[model samples]
Target: INSSIRSTYFVSKLRRISQIFYIELTPNKNLIMSVNGIYAEDSEGKFIPATQRPDGTWRKPRRVKDGYVPQEEVPLYESKGKQFAARKPQLPVGMSPEVALASRSKKSGPNVHCPIPGLVVLEDKTKKKKKKKDATVEKLANDLTQTKLDNTPPDPAKRLKNLKKKIREIESIEARLLSGELKCPEKDQLDKVARKIEILCEIKEIEKQIYWPIDTKYDFCRRL
Candidate 1:
């Protein structure tokens, strides 16, 4: 019974030693163990020695199990956004990539930042155009008012004489049309008729103004 117990103890110790040896000879670099501590491969395929702290305790090397990567082997992180593509200018059709890049660099001035090849930043001109349009309309209105003031004679008798002369001229034009003496285009005939009507309406308005002038005092009393 004592021989069997001694053999069992010896077998257990031998198994432990074999397991340790097997771990050391394993193909997995991450699981490899050394005399000091765990070993890790660096970027240059060199094995980094285990670290130690000032307290005489071993500092653990970062490992896959710890969810940590070695500093030297960490990959650079990149964003997959469209703005990332904007860094490189696009080449125009029928142009070589080299020439396109060269032209883009030349056109992109020092102050401009990341200018796209085909895009142009244009200044907004809507407000300026609206202001110019408004000024033109105002000028046209002023010119029309000034023309009306210049055309009207200051003396009422002179204005009445002018109105009568326009009526006579329109009557002669109508008589020539009835007698088939004057030839005119359809549009010109219509325009002349319209002008005659406008002149008659203006003469009637002048007569009314002269014969029936409004009394402001009477109008105020009526409003009250």
Candidate 2:
């Protein structure tokens, strides 16, 4: 009998606790419903109805439906053609479009002119300076050529020394070639041989000139 009474007491306590929990939760549920039904202010400062999304998040509403426009409504975007038309220059009264355009182009600048449509002709301002610079360079080049011609005949002693140095080099190269110490392509070897022959001929000419002094009066005759 005592166990049955204890069980009844526990069951009554559980019912009382459940009733208190329901009373406490009822006001919160009502508050959530009220908040969901509330209106929100959009960017335009206009109050619109707030909506609850399927994910339980609230979506702020706009006065107009999102991304929805009536077919009869004016488009929000301005086309390139309409923009070009709006930006086109207004012609003066009694003036042809071509005449007005030409007048405007003339007023723009003297340096910029167009003889043909779509082709701009620019005057080169540096042409005179470039011509002057070129003339000075040509004059300098001519002076250099004249100096080279005046110094064409080298001193005999210096010329002999140079020839002797070249002959020594050629002899060394020949020795290397014979001993197989220096390797060269067939074409290079042939060219070196030809050069050695020319140097020998030049040395002979120089020695002849040094041994026998040619009279300047007979020099012209020898040329003939």
Q: Once model 1 is optimally superposed onto the true structure by TM-score, how far is the C-alpha of residue 134 displaced, in angstroms?
A: 43
Off by over 4 Å in 2: 1-104, 107-166, 180-185, 206-212, 216-224
Which candidate number would show the highest TM-score if scored against the true structure? Answer: 2
lDDT of each: 0.61, 0.62
Q: What is the lDDT of candidate 1?
A: 0.61
Kindly list the per-residue Cα lDDT of model 2 for residues 1-224, writing each as its tens digit.
99998997786666557644543454322211222343333344323444445553555544645443445454578899989988875764455777656657776565555575444456676975787799999999999999999989988778887988888877887888889887763776657666876776676667667865665233322332
Residue 216 alpha-carbon offset, candidate 2, angstroms = 10
lDDT of 2: 0.62
Where's the lowest-lDDT run of ten residues in candidate 2? 27-36
TM-score of 2: 0.30
Winning model by lDDT: 2
The segments of candidate 1 whose C-alpha lies over 4 angstroms from its true place after superposition are 1-153, 185-190, 213-224
lDDT tens per residue, model 1, 163-196: 8897886788788888988776377665766687
